[model samples]
Structure formats: structure tokens, C-alpha cells
Target: MSCLFSPIKLREETLANRIVMSPMCQYMAKEDGFATGWHLVHLASRAVGGVGLVLVEATAVEPRGRISDGDLGLWSDNHIKPLERIVKAVHDLGGKIGIQLAHAGRKSESRAGIPVAPSPIPFDEGYRTPHELSEGEIQEIQERFAEAAQRALRAGFDVIEVHAAHGYLISEFLSPAANKRTDRYGGSTENRARFLRETINAVRSVWPKERPLFVRISASDYTLDCMTLEETLRLLGCLKSEAVDVWDISSGGIVPTGLQPVAIGAYPGYQIPYASRIKRELGLITMAVGLISSPELAEYTLQAGNADLIALGRELLRNPYWPLSAASALGEEIPWPKPYERAK
Candidate 1:
């Protein structure tokens, strides 16, 4: 079997292959954050198309944490059944599903209320200045993350990824450019990572040990003043005891637009080096993402030991059945859905 199509075990979850449908927000959820038919169809189609693991989009843990009003949420029990239906659909199609639990923080345009962050900094011009979270409020948000994990467990998701990247609440606290607090949650790298560390512990409190827990983090803020690769390494190293199973490495989104990395899509697998470095140094499983659409590139990345899994975002959105086609392209005879066997 080609490396891209080979099975890999993550904790007790054995993915059928290494092709992951990276979480991309659909921004199609209801105003109350309930999953609708669009979400069900969007995720299930990828399962039918033969993705190894289909991750649901960045779902908010609280109303104010949403990137917009349309983002999926798990802040309430009412959100559970809708997500459970999607999970059932994906499982029925023979694919494992995961959810990205996130908080957009100062980046939130949810209109729910004034967004909150570690500092009162706004994401960019024209964005509202976010409310700085106090110590008690920070702890409360951590509890909300724990509560959300419980909801995810009840929803029957096979994996739960903490979305700590992309200039969100956790990401805000992690980056000095965004975090200007004077408290323990905002000084040295250890202090900056404190929120994420505690958040992981909170989630792990309810999350099963056997099931893998993933954390998606931007390996770099792409600017010197913000989170650098070395900082990322140190930050992740400190979380080793949290028992995080996978580091889904993607870069940027910590800084605002103009100051972000210019080399993001300079080439395919551009972000693989970040994942490779993290995996190599930390001895952790890393998921390489960013423009890894081609079957050959995906296989080469694995063969070269750049990353353990290949995650695709826009590529998967453009072609839900990319994996099946990729399997054929690589000469691996993975099964197709019975209804689509003739095409195979």
C-alpha cells in the first residue's frame, strides 16, 4: 500500500488511511450554532469519498467565541443531538469523525457580544477591541472548554481537537503580539502557554484516555515578535504531560493579515517543515497541512518522515472524493462506496 493510503493507529482510533479532511469552517450553521443539513452533507460526502478521518469545522465553545454567528457551537446541550446526527452519518459511511473545538476571541465577529481575549487588543483595524479576560473569567472559559468536551463525548465523536491556533482565544494568549497581559497567563513562553495547558487539562479531565485528543496550533505566528517555531516547540514540550495525542501543525493566523507570512502557499507542502520539525524534536505525531493536495506529494511527505498524516482543507473542499481518486492515482485499490463501485 502507498504511504498515503496506509492505516495508522492514533491511540485506540485506527484511521483507515492518512488522508484527513482538515477542519474548514463552513459558516453555515444556524444562528444558535446548530448543525444543519449543509453540515451533515458536507462531512458525510467526504466519508463516502473515502477520507480516513473527516474533521468537523471549528466549533465554538461559547456564543461569544464564534468567528461569526454561523460557526458551529457546543456551548449548550441543545448542540449535542445535531452533532450526533452528523457523527452517525459519517460512521455509517465507514469513516471516523472528529471536531475542532475553538474560540475565536478578539477575532470574533459573531455579534453575540463584545468579544473577549487575554488582552483588549483588536484583531485589526475596523474590528472591535475585545474585552480583556480577568483571572476568574479565564478559569470560567477553561471550564466551558471542559463542558464542551463532555458534550463532544456525548455526541460520540471519535476525536476532539482543541483549536489553539489561528489568532483565536488560546492563540491570542499564546502570542505576545496579541497578549499584553501582566498576569501569570501572559509573560514568558511558559506563562503564555499556561492557558492552553490548563485548557488541555480541563478537556482531558472529561475526554477519554483511550481516544486520541488532538491540538491544532500554528507553529509560527510568522513574525519575529509573535510566536516563533522555537517558542512553539517549547510550548508543546511543556504540554507533554497533558497526554495530547497529535499536533496538527499549521502556521500563521496569530498576527493580522498584512504582517502574516508571505510564504504560506509559496509551494505545496510549504507547511510540512513546521510539522516535521515539531515531530522530530518533540517525538510527537504531527499532521502536515497547507496545500498538500497531490497524491505524490502526500506520499513523499510520509516517506520522507515529514509528517505522520496529511491534512487537506481547500483541496478537500474542491473535491470531496479526492481521496478515492488519489488512491487510484497512487495505484492503491481502496474500496469505493457500493453505490459508486461502477465508477471505481
Candidate 2:
């Protein structure tokens, strides 16, 4: 069997394959931040397509933490039922599902609330000038993260990925480019990693020890004078004691000077090197994401020991059946869902 189709045992959860559906924001939630039918269909289809792990989009831990007003939320009990239904659908389809709990920080665009950040940095000229969170508020957000993680448990999610990448709240604190606080969460690498470690600790407190915990982080900010790969490694080294089971590695969402979309590297598996280095150095299971659309590349990445999992966003969106198609393309026989067997 190809490594891409090999099962990976993550704590008590064992994924059927190494192809993961990367968390791509669907901005289709209701204004109140409840999951809608769109999420159910989107996630269920991927499960049916045979993705071993379907990571739901970056779900906001609090209303003010949303990247957009329409982002999924886990702030209240009301949100749990809708998520439970989706989780049940994925489970019924024999696929493991996970959620990416996130806070957008200075990048939040919620009209109903003002965005807050580690420092008072704005993402860009068009973005709002965020309030610098007080120490008390910082701790509260961590509690919110823990509360959301508990909700994930209630909803029957197999995994919970802390969305610390893509210039979100936690990522802002991790990146020196955005975080300018003089407090313990800012100056040195150890200090900068404090908030993320605290947040992870908070989540781990409520999240079951038997279950797996994943942390998604930007390995590099893609700009000079910002957080480097070395800084990221150091930060993760400090938090290794948190018992984080996996690293979902991605890059570059904190550059505020002026982001050039075309300037960022876009080659297939461009981020694999970072994931490989992080996995080797930190001794943690690592997942690589970013432009890895081809099945050959995904399988090759795994075979090369560059990453433990291959996560794709646009590739899966373009074709939910990418996994089944990939199995065929790679000369592997992954069982197709009964309903789609004739088509397969």
C-alpha cells in the first residue's frame, strides 16, 4: 500500500489515510456564527470522497475573534448541536474529522466588534487599528480557547487543531513582526512563545489526554526581520512539554508592510522543507500544507519522510473526490464509498 493511503495512529484516533482536508475558511456561517447547511454538505462530501481527516475551517473561539462575520463559532452551547450533526455525518461516512479553533486578532473583520491583538498593530492600512489586549484579557481569551476545545469534545470531534497560523491571534503573538509587547509574550523567542504555550496549556487542560491535540503554525513569515524558522523551532521546543501531538505547518500571514500575493513562494510542496525540519528537530508529527495539489507529490512527500500528512485546500475544493481519484492515479486501491462505486 502507498504511504498516502496508510493509516496513521494519532493518540486514540487512527486516520485511515494521510490525506487531510486543510482548514479553509468557508465564511458561510450565519451572522450569529452558527454552522449552516453549507458546512454539513461541504464536509460530508469530502468524507465521502475518502479523506482520512477532514479539518473543518478556522472556527472562531469568540464572536470578536472571527476572521469574518460569517465564520463558524464555538463560543456558546447553541453552536455545539450543529457541529455535532456535522461530526456525525463525517463519522457515518467512516472519516475522521477535526476542527481548527482560531482567533483572528488584528485580522478580524467583524463589524459587530472591534479586533484586539497582542500589540496594537494593524494588519494593513485597510484593517482596523486593534486594541492591545491587557494581561487580564489575554488570559480570558485562553479560557475562551479552552471552553471552545471542551465544546469540540462535546461535538465528538476526533481532533482539535489550534489555529496559530495565518496571522491570527496566536500567530500574532508568535511573530515578532506583529507582536511588539514588552511583556513576557514579546521580547525573546521564549517570551514570544508564552501566549501560545499558555493557550495550548489551557486547551489541554480541558481536552482529553487520550485524544490528540494539533497546533497549526506558520513556520516562517516569508519576510526578513520577522519571525524566522529558527524562532519557530525554538518556540515549539519550549512548548514540546505541552505534549502537542502534531504540527500543521503553513507559512506567511503576519506580513503587514504590504503583502504581495505573487511574491510568496507557490511551488508544489513549497512548505514541505519547513515541515520536515520542524518534524526532525522537534520530534513531533508534522503535516505540510500549501499548493500540494497533486497526488504524486502528496505520496512522494510522505514516502520521503518530509511530513506525516498532506493537507490541501484548493485541491480538495476543486475536487472533493480528489482522494479517490488520487488512489486510482497512484495505482492504489482505496475503497470507494458504496454509493460512488459504480462511478469509480
Candidate 3:
């Protein structure tokens, strides 16, 4: 029996398999940040195609924190309506789903407005210099994150994942190279981790205990004086105590370039080692992501005790039936849609 096809329970939700559809930005939302019919169909089709879990892309907790004008937002009640429909569609197909609550921070690409960050730094030429957020402003952002978690629950999500990775707001605060403030929000490691810790507590206060809540962190930031894998393990260990259900581990994303260092034209499972290390060191449930495109490779990672789950991003976007195909390739019998039974 392949563990890859086995069910795993997180809190009250039971995933049908280890395969998960990782959050990938659509950049298809309109100015209002509401989910369009395009968003509905895109996410629902993946569920129908047989992913155990479908995690929605990074949704901004505030308008100013958005990566682009096209990014989705869940900052207010108005944004919940359209997203509610999408969640329902996925659930109706018997697929579990989660929303990745996010704040882009310094990485707010500024499509129509000025970018904001922990400090005033430009990613590149013509990239807007970010306005450093003040203490009061930082608190407001934390409140927004809590509010967004409540909204996601009301919108019928089974799980919530705080996106603290990919050079986003939470990750920015944790990176000493980016946060040079002399205030309490910066200076020490504990101070740098303050925002994330507070935000997690705030979100947990509103999120149901029975439902799983996850935090995605860049496991190893390949930057000078940034949070490393050891630090990530320590953070995850603490978060696990705070009821964070799992840690979705990915790497890099501290600088202008994203996790390109780890994905440096690498083959499949390049980042699996990071997942393995974290899981072993922290003894925490982890979701392995990044360049895991092959069925054999994904299975190998699991069999080797690397990660509890496998999150597929671009590969699944390219082929929604990747899991179904994987099951077939592994000679495991996975039920196909009745309509596709003949094809199978």
C-alpha cells in the first residue's frame, strides 16, 4: 500500500490522499478583488479533477498589501460573497479546500499605488520604493489578518494557511536584511518574529479549533542575515504549540528574485531535502512543495519519510489530473469520474 494514496487527518478534516493543489496566483481578479466566474471555474475544475486539497492563492488581507491589482482580496465582507461561491463549488465536488491569507508587505508590486514595506527599498529600477509601515499601521495589518481569517471561515473554507513566505509581509518582518527599524518591531530575532506570532494568535482566536490552520514559511531564506532552516524549525516548533496544524515548507524568496536559488533550473524534488530536514528536526507535519512534478519522485519523498503531504503548483496547473495519472502510474486504483471511466 502506498502512503501517497493513504488518507491523513488534520484536526477534523480528513484529506482523501496526500496530493494537494498548492496555491498559485491567478492574477485574474478585477479591481475590487472579488472572485470572478473565472476564479470559480478554475478552482472548481481542479477539485473535480481529483486533488485531495485545493488551496486558494495568496489573498491580500488589506488592499495596500496586494502584490498587484489583479490579486484577490478578502479584507472585507464584500469580498466574501464571490469567494463563498467558489468554496461551495469545490466542496460540492467532495474536495477539501483552504485559503492562503497573505500580506505582501515590501513586495507589494504597486500596480496602481505606491508599494509599502518594513523599510524603503526598491526591488529594481522603476520598482516603487516602499513606504515603511509604522507601529500603529502594523497593528492594523495584524487586525486585518485576523478579520480575513474570520472571513475565510464564514466563506466555508475547511482550512486556512497564513502565507508568510515568498518575500511577503510576514517574511519581510522576519528577515533582518529587510527590516532595519530600531523600533520594537525590529533588531532582535524575537522582535522580528513578533508580527507573525501576534498575527497567528489573532487568527487562531477566530479560527475554529476543529479546523486545521497552517502556515507556509520560506524554510531557508538564502539571504544575508535572514531566517534560515534552523530558525524555521524553531519557529515551526513554537507554532505547533500554538495549534498551527502543519508547516508548508518552501525555500528562498528573501530578495528581489523569488525562490529561484532553490529552483535554479533544478530537477524534481530539489527542495524535498528541506522538507525532510524540517520534518525530522521539528517532528512536525510538513507539506513539501517546489519542483515536485513527477509521480515517482513524489512517492519517493513520502516513502522516505520526507513530508506528510505533497503540494503541486505549476504541474497541477498544467495538468489537473496529475494525481489521477500518478495513481494510475503507480498501479493504484483511484476512482475516475464516471464520465471519464471509459477513457481510463
Candidate 4:
């Protein structure tokens, strides 16, 4: 049997398979960060399409944390029922759903308030220079994360993945290039990891212990003087006591350097090695996310014990039913939704 179709358990949840639908932003929200019909159908379609885990896109913990005005937000109680609808529908249809709680920091393009970051660095050219968050503001941000996780609980989400990757708020703090603070929140690896550690602890406070909490990190910054994989390992070591259940590892985007980290002709499963190393050395469950678009390669990745989960982005966007097609490609039988079983 192909390992890609194999079941895996995390905390109280048992995933139907090893394939995860990685979170991708859908800028379709109507206003005020509410989930609309588009979101319910977009996520539900993937759940029905046979993904073991369907993670909602980067959701802002506060309104100012949104990457755009259209981004989803859980900063208020009113957002719960709309999201709860999607969660219940996914669960009823036989799939698990997770929401990636995020804060865009300097990356926020909402135009409502000045973006805030660990430092005053702007994301890149054409991006606004952000305000440096004061110590009090930092504490508030942590509480906001905790509050967002609490909202997730109320929304009936099965899992919560903290969005610490992709040059967002947490990623800005994690990367040295974006964070140049001389205070306790910067200067050393331990200090730099402080925000993330506190964020995890704060979320874990309100979030139930039995439910798994995942942390997505940009494992490598792919730039000189930025956080290297080694630095990330040291940082993760500091965060180990926080009890992070999984490391959804992705690299780059911590800085806006225009250069490609991989040379021309990068292939599938490019980021597996970084995840495998973390799993081997740090003893953490790691999910490899990159261009892992092929079923054969994804199966091989699991069979080789390179990574615990295979996260796909673009390919899944092209085909919500990619997992079903993949099962057929690998000559494995997985039950399809009753309405679609006739095609199977």
C-alpha cells in the first residue's frame, strides 16, 4: 500500500490519510473578515475531494493583522458562526479542518492602520514602513493570538496551526533581516524566538491540551545574515518546552530578497530534506511543504520517512480532487464521496 494513503494520528485526531491541503489565501471575504459562501464551498469542496486535513487560509487574529481587507478574521465573536458553518459541514462530510491563525505585521496591506512589526522594517519595495511594536503592544499581540485560538475552539475547528511562516508577523520576528531590535525580543536566537514561544504558550492556554497545535515556520531564510536552518534548529530547541505538536516547515519568504533560493529547474519535493533533517535531529513531527505535486513522489517521500505529511498548494488549487486522482494513480483504493463514487 502507498504510504501517502496511510492514516496517521495527532493528539485526539486521526487523519484519514497523509495528504494535507496546505492553506492558501482566498481574498474572497466580503468585509469585516467574515467567511462568506465562497469560503464554505471552497474548503468544503476540498474536504469532499478527499484531503485528510483541510487548513483554512491565513486568518487574522485582529483586524489590523489582516494581509488585506478581504482576509478572514476571528478578532470578534460575530465571525464565529460563519466559520462554524464551514467547520460543521466539513466534519459532517467526513474530514477534519484546521485554521491557520496569523498576524501579517508589517505585511498588512489593509490600509486601516499602520502595520506593526518587531522592528520598523517594511516588507519590501512599495510596502509601507511599519511601526515598531512597543513591549505592551507585544503582550497584547500574544493575548490576541490566545483569543483567536479561543475563537477557533468556539468555531468547532478540529485543529489549529499557528501561522509563523511566509514572512508574516511571526516570520518577521523570526528572521533577523526583518527584526533588528536591540531589546529582549531580539539580538540572540533565544530572544528572537521569544515572541513565537509566548504566542504558542498563550494559544495553548485557551486551546485545549488534547487538541494538537501545529507551528508553521520558515525553516530557512535563504539569505545571508538572516535566520539559517541551524539558527532555526536552535530556536526550535528553545521552543521545544512549549510542546509544539508539529512543525509545518517551509523555507524563504522571511525576507523579500528577489533572488530564487533554488537554481533553475527546481523539481518536486524540494523542501523535504529540510523537514527530514528537523525530524531526524530535533525529533519533531514535520510536514514538508513546497512543490510536492506528484502522488508518486509524495508516496515515496512518506515511504522513505522523509517527512510525516505532504502539503500541496498550487496543484491542489488546480484540482480540489487531486487526492482522489492521486489514489488512483498510486493504485490505491480510497472511498470517494457518495455523490462522486459513481465516477470512481
lDDT of 1 at 29: 97
Please say which candidate is ahead in TM-score: 1 or 2: 1
Off by over 4 Å in 3: 111-113, 237-240, 258-265
Instruction: Give the alpha carbon lDDT tens digit for every residue of 169-264 in model 1.
Output: 999998898999888998888899999999999999999998999999998887865688888888887777646988999888877777675445
Provide the TM-score for each candidate, comma-separated. Answer: 0.98, 0.97, 0.94, 0.97
lDDT of 3 at 315: 92
* CA lDDT for candidate 1: 0.91
Report the lDDT tens digits of candidate 2 across residue range 1-344: 89999999988889999999999889899977899999999999999999999999999999989999989999999999999999999999999999999999999999868999988878998999999999999999999999999999999999999999989999999888889999888888888889999999999999998888999999888866666788788888887865588899998888853563335667888999999999888778899999999889998989988899999899999999999999999999888888778997
* RMSD values, in order shown: 1.2, 1.5, 2.0, 1.4
True-structure lDDT of candidate 3: 0.84
Against the true structure, candidate 2 reaches a TM-score of 0.97
Better of 2 and 4 by lDDT: 2
Ranked by lDDT, top first: 1, 2, 4, 3
Best of the candidates, TM-score: 1
Off by over 4 Å in 4: 257-266
Residue 192, candidate 4: C-alpha displacement in angstroms? 0.1
Deviation from native of the Cα of residue 47 in model 4, angstroms: 0.9
Model 3, position 317, has a per-residue lDDT of 83
